[model samples]
Target: MSFRAPHDGELLKSEYALRGFLPKADPLTAFPCGSPYAPLDEIGRDLPSLLYDKGFRSYARGLRLPPWQTRVSVETLPLLRLYYVRIGFLASAYVNQVGEEPVETLPGNIAAPLIDVAQRLRRPPILSYDGYALYNWKRFRKDGPIALGNIDTIQNFVHMYDERWFILVHVEIESIAAEILAAIANVKRKLAQDANADLNRELWRIEGAVRRQVETLKRIPEHMDPKLYYKTFRPYIRFFDGVAYEGADTAPMQFRGETGAQSSIMPMLVAFMKIAHRRSILTDHLDDMRAYMPAEHRTLIKEVAALPDIGAPAYREVFNAILDAMASFRRVHYGWAEDYINRRTDDPRGTGGTPYMRWLQQLLTETEARRL
Candidate 1:
């Protein structure tokens, strides 16, 4: 609930904390039909009901969707993301929604804008964590805190509280990441100045931030029933396997779903905490998740990761605590994935389109192994 971005301006990635990786502006609720891309926002608003209607695909085809001019710029980046995320939801729902067959080709009206907006952002034209959590929420009050209690998801695949709670929980956790990022930034500054004594304290702060994230992550079951999550809403966010954009590209274009792996927070922590995982399929997939993150967030991980090791014998214990905290976080994630996804289906693949059961266990095991 508290905004923990560094008090000092020099401390963290500005994009990570500024108005919460969530857009500072309230996203437009509707675009006029005059806009070439009105369906993204307009039909997107009514998507839940339309999804259930057997005629949904035909209805989408009925709309007149124009190709994007691609006149996007960094200044209106949030707007483009707004358009991108909405269209992404539409495409996912059209393909994965219950009544429809899992269609292999994404419609051009949807594909065109999705690809155009995504090209501008330099990320895959799919619903990623940036679209799913970071750009998917709005606050109840104009001046309220950007926390779970005050915010709600802007677009949803279904009209369920479980869906709302599921997304907002990530929003709250992303807010908590500010504290962790501040700690990482201070550690970087201390490392640069050869201040080993002060580094331990900052490392402890990082451990504390990881603990806070675990607490929020643990609250997933309180409002969101795992059954509803798995059966109803989860399908819309799964990997785009063998699916091609109707007009954008004819080849089968695949991208990971809007999973937590795409979140910049944990990757930044992984790089900053120095918890080295042995190379494996899971590590490669983790590395691949970076491509789904915002470009600056990707750069931030690189910047933190490029720092030389702490190298001080005294800081090893604190660093070990940080590793243990990270392992604990992964353990909680692994447990829920088992309870929620693994038990429900035969498919070993998670939303990230990886063998998640093995992958998560591997992650937890690797982090524990790095302990001093």
Candidate 2:
């Protein structure tokens, strides 16, 4: 099958270079105070304390929150991202904070801004991976590496350090994804020209990056206690099922939670590596997750997916190594699910609202079978 090449791969390369995948969703950013939007900022700054107080739901329901009805300007995108995070966190807390059962409706004040920002951002209105992880961190020191201990979360539902660690672990993973994204950027030109040697070189680079990503991902349990993670902060970001928005014209929305599924790293890699997962309920959920990622990232995955297959013998080995790294990530993830979520409850649905144990097995088998 022939794929038409973009000019000089500029569109492809520049898309991956945009850094939307990083914490540059802005640590230095905040909405201006006492403006119409100040309520969200104040609520965000007060989230941890407010969550502990039994009055959190009352306080959330009582807010004179902004409608944010104006068309979002391109210049305000960074601050807009911060707006989504703060308001999204508050909304999650409102739903899951101290309820007999998680709330089924978002009040008008809470729903309006979320519906607005999420539509403008081309993602679901709930707190998906972007709000919960990618944009959730800020480096403690300006010059510090974006690694564990150096990074901390900007927002949380609880006061535990495990919450911070859980979010930061994903932040660190996103940071390592830069190298893999760079390798992907280079491959567009190689594929366009049929430069098999260069393509093979990039396949190796991607394999190394995946291995490094796995190494960093393995550090999740270092400071995050599984019980703390499962019990305290996890529920705030759990999936939305038939949840209605009070004032918006929108009907009840069913979106996945703040999940690892929404991360673009693996989806982009699966697309780039030419690994096609079998069609199943799990694969459909995986495809649906792209709707919650940044639109440019979704586009990039499609671009990478369109690149021709690398099926040579040597290319196959590098592909297998990358799959090995992916499998290792999956194994660690399995241990996490077992320790953090599965053992703790009888419910089969994970935070992402999938029967993940069965899904993961399918994933492992598919990855092994798709080598070259």
Candidate 3:
């Protein structure tokens, strides 16, 4: 029962002070995208209950392993719930964004100001500490059955802390989605031009559809102050296993939990691209991610993939751009790793043990080799 003592707690406070952890509004006030089953804000209400009920029910009916295993599964439900909130919010946001405009209408000239403002928004590096995940939030509740029993509890649980990290992650999601949509639009435009037409009706339709989605990102709440998030909330968001580990003491620590790697939008985009191309390498990883998405968003993505003339000659170039995006994302996060993990821990494990990091490198390498 020995914890890391005053050092970890003191360090957390100091770091929070140093980083300027001030949130202007509640992070839950930040929107979730639209869902058919629920409103945009409450889109993922049923997830926790669904997962818990299904998981134990399935275990009961089928693979009855060990009692401890079942307990482990129950214990892990909160983590799954938290993950769903983070990612489901993104999917819901995207869905709501798509709903802002009808696909039948042409994507009008998006104002320069909108694009400029979004472009100017700073993208922060992914920070990792061993403590954020360590605190079992479920235990913090009074009537704690170690499960997110209802939507109200789920709502309260997520907003219990400053969720600036999730907000930042949402920013990345929108930015990356916008980039991909732009690339798709460019491809569509080129295809239209090649067909000896003044205006490609299909291209306009595609542009309108993608543009609506991209513009929705612009509506993501601006409540998160970057300085505040990094300084205050980020430090406390650790990966300590609660009882056994209390997390690090000093500034800049290695990332805890696989979520630091898994929940990243770039990796998910890369996964989607691979799946579209029928690449089986990361199917399991993608499947795990799929659980985080709203059902409609998944259907929307499928429709995007099936768009006519998407796999044209321009597909290679667009695909290469996507690969580049994934590489660039890795580079940024790697820089954080270098500063936090490598420099602090003195372990040169950048892109070494992390499967997602290695996957990005391998994918890039294979892509370049194919070009050669």
Candidate 1, residue 244: how far the Cα is off, in Å = 2.2
Clashing pairs in 2: none
TM-score of 1: 0.90
> Candidate 3, after superposition: displacement of residue 248 in Å?
33
Off by over 4 Å in 2: 1-20, 23-25, 33-35, 69-71, 193-197
Q: Which of 1 and 2 is ahead in TM-score?
A: 2
Models ranked on TM-score: 2, 1, 3
Give candidate 3 regions above 4 Å deviation: 1-176, 182-283, 308-322, 342-356, 367-372
Which whole-number lDDT from 0 to 100 does residue 52 have in model 2?
80
Query: How well is each residue in 1-372 modelled by candidate 3, as lDDT tens digits?
Result: 111111111112222121111111112322324422123234244322333242422222232111111122444433332333333222222211211321111111111111222122211111121112211122234443222221112231133233533334333333234334444334334433454322234334333433433333333233444444333333323222221111222333222222443332333343334433235544344444433332323443443344343323444554444445444444555444443334444332321123454444554455344320
Q: Deviation in angstroms for 15 in model 1?
A: 4.6
Candidate 2 per-residue lDDT over residues 1-372, each given as its tens digit = 333444553324543454427744345445665556666766787888887887777778888877665556666676777788988888888877844478789888888888888988888889989888887788778677777878888778887888887888888888878778777777776656764435667778878877877888888888889877877888888888888989977778887888898899888878866777899998998888889898877877777777666655756678788888888887878778788888889998877888888888788778778775
Two-way lDDT contest, 1 vs 3, winner: 1
lDDT of 2 at 324: 88
Could you estimate the TM-score for every candidate?
0.90, 0.92, 0.35
